[model samples]
Target chain A: MTLSEKNLKNEIYDFKKFYHLIKAFTISTNISCKAFNLNGEKIASFKGPESDTSFCKLIQKLNQEKNYCMQSYIYGGQQSEKLGEAYIYFCPYGLVNWTVPVIKENKVRCFLTAGPVLMHEVDNLLVENAVKMCPMLDKRRKEIKSKLSKIIVVDTIRVKYLADLLLKLAKIIMAEDAVDLNNKHELNIFNAHLVENINEIKRTYTLQGKNNKISNFQEKEANLITKVTSGDKEGAKKSLNQFLGYIFFYNADNIEIIKCKVIELMIRLLQVVTEVGVDYNVVSGIKYKYLKNLINAGDFNEISKNILEVLDYLIDCLTPLINVKNRNTILIAINYIRNNYHKDINLEEVAAQVGLHPVNLSKMFKKETGKKYTDYLNEVRIEASKNLLLRDDLPLVQVAFSVGFNDQSYFSKIFKKIEGVSPNKWRVLQKEQKNFN
Target chain B: MDREILNELTVALQKGDAIKTQKFVKIALKKGYEPEQILTEGLVSSMNTIAEKFKKKQIFVPDLLLATRAMNAGIFILKPKLKKQLFSPIGKVLIGTIEGDLHDIGKNLVKVFLERAGFEVIDLGNDVPVNYFIEAIKKFKPQILGLSASLTTTMYGMRDVIKALEKEGLRENLLIVVGGVPITESFATGIGADIYDMDGTKVADKAKEKLKCSNF
Candidate 1:
């Protein structure tokens, strides 16, 4: 199916409101305008009452080339899409015509075509050109000239202004493109500086390197999964943002690749959190909704927001995993361990906090989360220590003590056991992967 | 040859960067590089790639227009320096989007490429009427006239301008180059144009060839 069919569902992409806006736009501008969907079908149009006998309508009616008008509009729209701006071109009838692509998430949702009107007066020379433009105009020269003279001649600059306004309207029309559409009217337009655009292109040109080997984000990905699994929502969000920025910069102008990367990233993140004894039905339900949202994401920023939203929800669901619904004592025990893992807290302390015996807490934690209580706490400390280890200022001994390990050698032992490499070696792998060129 | 700067300039121009193109041209100039080398190796070479991509749909018309603008930015810096060389300007060409035609992207691109090819081009911009072309031809006395119209309804405007040029007895030595979409080789002949380039990319070369052959 087409992109429009995939995303422009009635609930998500509103058309009724768009029709009203375009109608008002045409009436206010006093210019005849038509809108075409992504498939180039005429979705809606408005002919101001004053433009009933517009030169375009008469010319099309009189001419034998029936599809020429539509063809010209389609060409103008396609050019505007390719140009990424308003395309001002002449119509087949030698009249001023222009189109502005209504882009949602950098995809053309609709095209607003605004003309086929005369920019000049109906002078004798113009009439002569028209007379030769078509054989049907041979006998209708006087009428054609009279019809053209009656239409309002918009100033060239004002026509450009109208085109810009039409594009703004197009943006508004596509505001529903966001999954969370309530406050998403803050759309981007070329109403900003060209310098910013060039700089953006420049940065992407640098980051998109010859093959994106500038840096490997393996450590960052490990850092993020730890945050998610350990229920560090706030830290996970920061990591997610940084991770997305790196990937987006690394793969600019190649959004399909970025989207695929995001899909893989999000599924891995969800997998890490959902492996707990959360109900299978609930996990899949949330998974389906968020994955759909990610697939329908329009831009990198939107993709980031979509994944963050899911993270917020899944993490919130994590908070209540011990509630009256399941009375899940294991989650309470795990939450207690997450809070005190950086300190020298033990399973008895966590069991007492959740009002369970030490033996019961340990057994439930292992049964539900599939990890021993001590092993889970060590994983949390190791994940936390990984963050501190990414910095050079923090010495290894201090990193071990800060993450609740009593001795530096023991921190190294656990880190090596979980990661198959020492912390020092992991840092070297990360530091050495910076290929700036 | 400072091939590195030239390569970066090519990449910047291909990416449609005006400021970066200007920056590279200035850097090369300050480094004592020849303006001709920068023009041919940097601007013209990138534009040739753009034209090839445009034909293959790897890029679009707006990309070509932007690359042309960047090339123009480079030339704006290079024009004065180019006067020291003998290929500064071999001939003059008058070009426009023709009467009632508003699409100037194609026209601007051809103008910049011609200017880089050592031909001084006088651009009359969009919607230029037949008389303006006739008057510009009389005043500029260019060896060629390039008529560009991006729409079918208006491309035939070339015929009227050609007829007017012939009527004024200005077609004898003037090579009329008609271009734009919907303008095929047959249509070019039908419209009385001497050259029928789909795009005016090679009009400058054709103009030079005809000028040399006819000894105009």
Candidate 2:
């Protein structure tokens, strides 16, 4: 459903109760939050009586140009909207803040920006930069310092956790009128880190030489069916790319020949994935959608891109069945992790949801998944973040924050420790690899 | 023989010190350093370090572009000297952005990458129409033609150029490599392009491989 159908102003029936709810949030977390409409006017802001955030309000009240703060908020909101999540960033005043966009009909109708906390120690340089916009602050340096000290010092991990919670919180405040606000599920681009596999296919095609004919189709289809049934979605897609690459290579000048081959292959795949044991209508729905796509495909290149999308959809439809049928606790937990890895989900919460003690969950998870819970979650987040890195328009910080990392520095450190190169460098390396033979 | 001068040159380049880097290159040349030695040690090695630093996030894009400018300046002082040596260009490449697209920074980067890899490049610049490409291809008869387009609206211009080349019977021996923001392998092949590479730094390698395997 489109977000405008449930719009922002219609979300809550009672403002007093909502204000108290947001106030409770501040009391527990020691962070201040303000929600704003599209025109840059405040809709709701709750300040806990126990803590003070006169620092930012004082800046807006005293500053010459009030638009800088709003501009930063706008920029941050645009970024979060792009990534489909909350974006944690350092504001112009060097305070850690996050913006979560509540989009409606593709426009940000409202947004919530939270946090003015200190991640690092406040210093003279930071204080000077913070108040440089106001000449009256020349005498108020001491006052600013004391107020900055009053701001809470938060760790990056806790910041990310709170921001993840705040994302849901923002949507909750905006979606109260809708039947289901969580329907906007993001598909995991299943061919995660397929750089090596894509190149391998190219190398194999080159090694197969221009003169060698694919004398038979049975061997190739068998190879793909093995991957698909074994739940190796990436391997299945790799086989598909390899299969399509050969067709395109051999028939570069003939679109009709390649289309004929793709149609024959799609008929075979319809039989293979149909065995997944979902309902008849569901399988038929998947069949109708994919068949229509392939039939409407314009060229061999279109087929190459769409077939991967088909695999992603089919896997999305079928994997739930596999997980639900198993009813294995470890498998269930892993499935849960895969679905929610983009959020700040922790072992304790997953354990609670799955009805296991935290310690047992940790032990069983390690024994089953062959890694610690944290490692697996981090790897999942890292794999997903790798997809975002390929887009040059995205900043390193936003990719980190969108994938549940709070600090760009820490993201780089972890990325290097895991991927052996920094994120941007890894991107450059991937682009350097030959994509087509 | 002061090897330390090359070290100083590298530091200057990484710092994006264009004047100091050129000064060091001229000084190194006057100190009787071989032109090949100065090119590799003072210029190429510094660009390599910048790439390495960028990969490690020790520096960022502004730093990288600044260092690239510094290295380009050093190359300005060193190119004529290198021509005196036995080293030579490996092949010819004709490149341009398609019509209605004014973006050329990516095209320029690919040009730099191809030049550094020793392919002689004849740049037709940006917003180029079809006939200019055909005329250049006929004149230069380069081994590869690189077509770039940043906008979806203009990317189809690459296809139009390829079709025009085929109509003129010039598509037989030429390899067409397509790239830019909107140009994917699918779009490349959809338009009958021979290769699609997004990375400027490695397009030269693909060109070299194609050249090696071809009759030319």
Candidate 3:
């Protein structure tokens, strides 16, 4: 079912609120529960009494299992039959365990189970009753019951909220249809805009070596030109106070380099002014100086204005370039790569398609991401191979080819390089682990 | 053989006319002027004009490249004659595009600028591995090491290369200059780079500043 934008947004909002609830419950009650997949993939879990990586991994394993079964023991004559594909196997003392299925479209997508409760209360009547009943807990029964109760209470709320959030998230994901939405118009516009600005900066730098000598001003002007050109306004102001020093060094032809430098500085200054997005007053002081210099030279006001306008435009162009989100580009590139992994791809072609030079693109891609293009491609291919390897139904050669590897041996070589084992070995390991579990 | 031929040579080099540059260089040589004088006065200045125009935005990369080609032509004619009187090395610099990056345009620009600015730059080409940079550092003992990484991922290679240099105690003695698209002043600071330039032209200026200060 397609989800509208409004529906997806609502779901996300609901899910966020639900997460807060879970966070509060886990903190207050000291109970821990988690949502897992049928194969034991623990999607989300509250912090247990003792955090263990193996326990987490085991939860993931159980979530991955396709079959759903429930079995409970104890409680004497008050026996409870499983209500769903999974159940909440709660002990009387409040410590709870068991996986409850979260179903969507008749498929057991997620499981919510709560356990290890710690009940915080006065340990008088309840503690006495627990000590009398369930003789297995007779030794330190009060301590066990109190801890168990708290753990169960805290954990159950957390799991329930988690399940609620997961259900909301699923609805949102189903609604948003990320793959389709990402390909929509607005994102494309944003990407294009980013590409344009980057291209412009690159083109300008290539065309204009970042140096130009202003060959006109006096020494005072020359020094001012230098400071301004170097993007140091305060220094320019400090040195400008010594007017005689400038006049003594005034050489018209010698200052050509300084003149060119000032114009370039003016351009850079305009870029900064626009990006600041402040009122004209912020730059009005600099603007006045620029105008005064022109006025002193008897240059037309119209000419100065025109030049400033162009400078402003150039500066405006740079903001998008500077602010271009690296993550977005990497995300787009990842999506593109995933779709086209089977195709023969190279940095030059991809860069061209993405509107970057082959070298710059390679550099940017590597810098933004921690992997080279070839390595990233290999990672995706390896991941695909892993999923295929799990299926005993698919032949090794066929699985390799299906995942875009031309030769099974070459695939095995790269797979071993990445996975640190042969594909068959990896498959066997996975199978053995499954059987053991 | 006339002074006019010298002017023609300059013009040809300025316009990046390689054939004309070669012909003019041959004529000037036949006229018995010292090749070294001809090189410094004619070819260098001729290329200087092109570089100036490049700096002024009056010429672009293709124009600069073509002029460089012409400058090379004149060099071909004068090379043998100037062979005995080798150009004194101003300073040794090891330059390369960092590992995982193959963009050499910026690296090449920096090399050319350094050469013109009187530094003897050892071009290490593109996609240079960390070990190679460290090896070059050991072998050349350059005063400055210019590392160019156009990609973000490849820039990490700079850290590794620097670490290797430090491991060998070379980093203490050497000046590290970095430049590229993804590199920023903040990033340079973060990475403990001695100098960082946003572009190739700025790389030359920053290199000069670093060399002068030699604070490291």
Candidate 4:
């Protein structure tokens, strides 16, 4: 099914022959001709006024009578007999009929038909018929003669030989068409399969990679900023520091476009890793001090000292509320929650840990995160619970307890309530669905 | 009489006194105190206090870095002799900047405090890709995998390391802790990363508490 360059070329070559044959027939017999392939695309035609649809309709008629009339019609040449079947007509202007069936695997894949030729070569035939049909045709004699002159006699021998050649050529065309189609089909299948896997692999790496790259930049940026701000001096010293800061910060911008490109390379890297994964720590670190300077010069409020700000910005493009004053209470609360999320802890304990009354801390939590204190606590707990669930060796009860719930039953209830499924159910579904390997 | 020496030792450490740091360590060790204890109680404690001051902006990263160097100088002099009985480490940690990323300031700061807080830290340097983390995990076999990413783009490499570790059956043996600018508790949770914190100073204690948990 894979499409190689060779098979494609052969199909094009076959189509060219079809085109030439149609043109040659038009010249030889001076009859308007057309060839429609199986898909109803007009592959060859000598019709100037007639549309592709007209030829397509004729082919359909020929196909319907393929069993009864195909052989007789091709052999009849210019003298083909016509019977009433919704397709046959005896017009003075022209008579139309099939040449031969272009069979593939014994089924017709295409048809060659010549049509709309003058039935009688006499100059007065159209004029006489038009007068019988309509008086206007008497005035249209020159036009009728011109139309009749275009319909010359069909040489029966040449017609039969050309039909035979076309039939054989159509067979070859169908064979090569099948080969090319199979190649295209397979290529499409392969591309879809590979593209799907590549996408999945890329998606997996991009999320994690974004976090790491952003954090690295944040840490490095902070360090350089700290260096510049702490060593602040007037005039030349400030300019030098600002210049260095600009260089460092600008490096982060330069890194933006490379993110997608590096992600592509990492996808390939991930494929290799999964195949024969390694376990080795090789430090190939790049120094980014120059990039930090650019960041320091920018309004510090636009940046966050917390690595997560950079991470959030890079991953989600979050614009955190810029503030001149540091939210120390939030920092303290966050630190306390992070340290004690796994322990048997509560909002009061966290409030106590941050030296705030429970009510005030609750309000502060909501103010900072737009959620109530207990909601934040539960959010943290459920988040941790999900991680523990991945470690299947841990009992569901233990996993629940590990994330701060004292009662396993309560943990399961809340976990299901938040996750919309019990921990065990979540674990089971996850296991059944994803190998995670 | 001993009060004078203790006061001078405290002042020397507080004032970024390198020479006094070595002298205080030598004198403290000579006075029947263990070198490891001197490191834990004197050298590390001073750095911890210095970190707090730095956090308050009273001291800067350079001042903190200088203090840590002073602390390291003392530790270096004491480390070989006290090799058999190193201070009860806060916890054994395998920390690194994830691969394809080279920003190391946050990681370095975390290392300073985590080590100062009596943890044995094996810092796999910046731009450490997933393979490095896996390798470090296998070699050091630390209970915690502390990953740092400075670039939002490269931070996702942590997931690769996480997956690699999981595939290797190493996740169960280790608590995967992540920190960086872009990393979130949600992201850590999303990727099944164990512990996520915003600041390097907090990461050490968070790792400590997590490691202490029998379940972790």
State the displacement of the C-alpha of residue A437, model 4, in Å, after optimal TM-score superposition.
99
| Interface RMSD over true interface Cα atoms for each candidate | 17.9, 9.8, 27.0, 33.9
Deviation in Å, model 2, residue A368 alpha carbon: 17
Docking class of 4: incorrect
Question: lDDT (0-100) at residue B146 of candidate 1?
Answer: 85
TM-score of chain B only, all predictions? 0.68, 0.65, 0.61, 0.61
Per-prediction DockQ:
0.03, 0.03, 0.01, 0.00
lDDT of 2 by residue, A235-299 (tens): 88768756764565456456677777776776666566677664556556766777787778765
Per-candidate local distance difference test: 0.69, 0.71, 0.56, 0.53
What docking class should model 3 receive? incorrect
Judging by lDDT, tell me the better candidate of 1 and 4: 1
Q: Model 4's A-chain: what TM-score?
A: 0.26
Per-residue lDDT of candidate 4, residues A1-437 (tens digit): 11223422333445565566556655664555554444444455565343223322433353454332334333332221111001222232223343433434434444455554322243343345444444445565676555445444333233334444444444455664444333333333332232223233334445565444455435544553333222222221223223223322323323333233223322332233223322212101111221343234232212212221222222121112112111677788887887788887777888787677888778767877787877777788998888888887999778877888888998888787788998899989889878764
Lowest lDDT block of 10, candidate 1 chain A:
A186-195
* Higher-scoring candidate on TM-score, 1 or 3: 1
Q: Which pairs, if any, clash in model 2?
A: none
DockQ, cand. 2: 0.03
- Candidate 3 lDDT, A20-83, residue by residue in tens: 5445544554445554444444456665444223322322344334222221222110111112
Error of 2 at A127 (Å): 7.7
Candidate achieving higher DockQ, 1 or 4: 1
Task: Estimate the TM-score for candidate 1.
Answer: 0.33
What candidate 2 gets wrong by more than 4 Å, as runs, is: A1-9, A12-21, A48-66, A90-95, A103-109, A118-153, A170-185, A188-224, A227-265, A273-286, A294-437, B1-216
